[model samples]
Target: MRKRERENPCGVCGHYHKYEEGEVCETCGHRMLATSEKASVHFSAFPSEILPQFLYLGSYDNASRSELLKTQGISRVLNTVPACQNLYKNSFTYHCLQDDKSLSFDDANQFLENCERDKARVLVHCMSGKSRSPAIVIAYLMKSKGWRLERSHQWVKERRPSIDLAEGTLVH
Candidate 1:
């Protein structure tokens, strides 16, 4: 077996064990290791004022307030939470999603793309401005701007410091 496999868990021990080639586990004397460990990459938060001028990332509270939207000259909203009320339904174009982690974002992506084509200033928000909204915004950046998932995530994070992306949501 390769060195990578040997560094994994030995199945008996819950934690990974270090063993040389042809060497048994120090704790259990087992030669095998669990291959269930998945690799993940972490991104750092950067300090930059490079937010897109026409796009806004905010929370439900920000969406609920008419004055906030008006003050920012927001012309549309992409709401990613299920059953989220369109507070200014008549005033702005609204696109609502159910906010499930497994939800496909094709429609949301199309809506944001349309907004971009029309040069519409839009506010994208979910319940807490954390998982769902950020995921959608990241998707928009990927689809519309031709950005990779990691770069899109970093760009959104730079603008919205409070965004907490859901696990496995940052797909290219």
Candidate 2:
């Protein structure tokens, strides 16, 4: 229903089109209209109420992890993976233990405290973006929202249908 973005140059690759018929980007293979639609709809994901100034990028998947970091407006990135801490430390703002299976509430609180102090928009990343990272996010939500851990997890699940907290992670 909408027209393609042949007129606008691609921001990612910076290539222009030759004519009105040319809707796709000239340089990159990406579709112009789709990119514009995504840009327009992205702000809807972060609602003003429950949405944290912080983001939870979640575990070690290449796509979600990279997208979270490369997102348009992000202030801080926290790589919660211990194994790859040294690799991404210089690139990111914080690198805490990636203790996914056994995430302690204290650690979550401490991380949130740091975020509050810095006034930064934090993105918590792990590997799969499912279990480990969601657990920490759940912990944070529970602490901040005063909801039971299970309820907090449910709330996040509503927004991110794919999320599944690691086993035994629901207990506070």
Candidate 3:
């Protein structure tokens, strides 16, 4: 007589059952599942040091953003466009939905005011971490840090080497 085999937990369904590759879970009948990749978002300094802070989330959709926000203590989102409906589920009290069309220093300063008043850390994102996000972040640094525009641009670039704001686009 053969002994019954113990089962592994289904990655998608969380049910413990004996399953094989391409096998459906008995409870949910999900044929496929995946283990999430655990990745850390890299930043230049400790959380408290960066003023009116900026975080780069690389490339994540709404669900990922919501999950990360819960863990990271991010209080607001400076989104280039509004997230998908119910993306935040009313979790956050503040949002600044800006366009990617040539952001200015005044715009960034306005965003800083909201963050300062609410005591919230801010995140700015575009599709990639290269151009648009860096533009806004540089502007914020100029207003908050009193750094020369060129120096501010160099600062974030040294920490996040991938930043590549286009020529003549940074707010003077």
* Model 1: lDDT of residue 158: 78
Give the per-residue lDDT digits (tens) of candidate 2, residues 58-132: 433332233445463455555555543333454456646645446565775787668767776666655444566
Question: What TM-score does model 3 achieve against the real structure?
Answer: 0.57
Clashes of each: 0, 9, 0
The CA lDDT of each predicted structure is: 0.66, 0.53, 0.53
TM per candidate = 0.65, 0.56, 0.57
**C-alpha positional error of residue 166 in candidate 1 after TM-score superposition, expressed in Å:** 2.3
* TM match of model 1 to true structure: 0.65
lDDT of each residue in 16-104, candidate 3, tens digit only = 55543556555533344233312333332222223424443222232235656656677666554333222464875444444435555
Order of the predicted models by lDDT, top scorer first = 1, 2, 3
In model 1, where do residues sit more than 4 Å from their true spots? 1-51, 98-101, 170-172
Query: Candidate 1 at 56: error in angstroms?
Result: 1.0
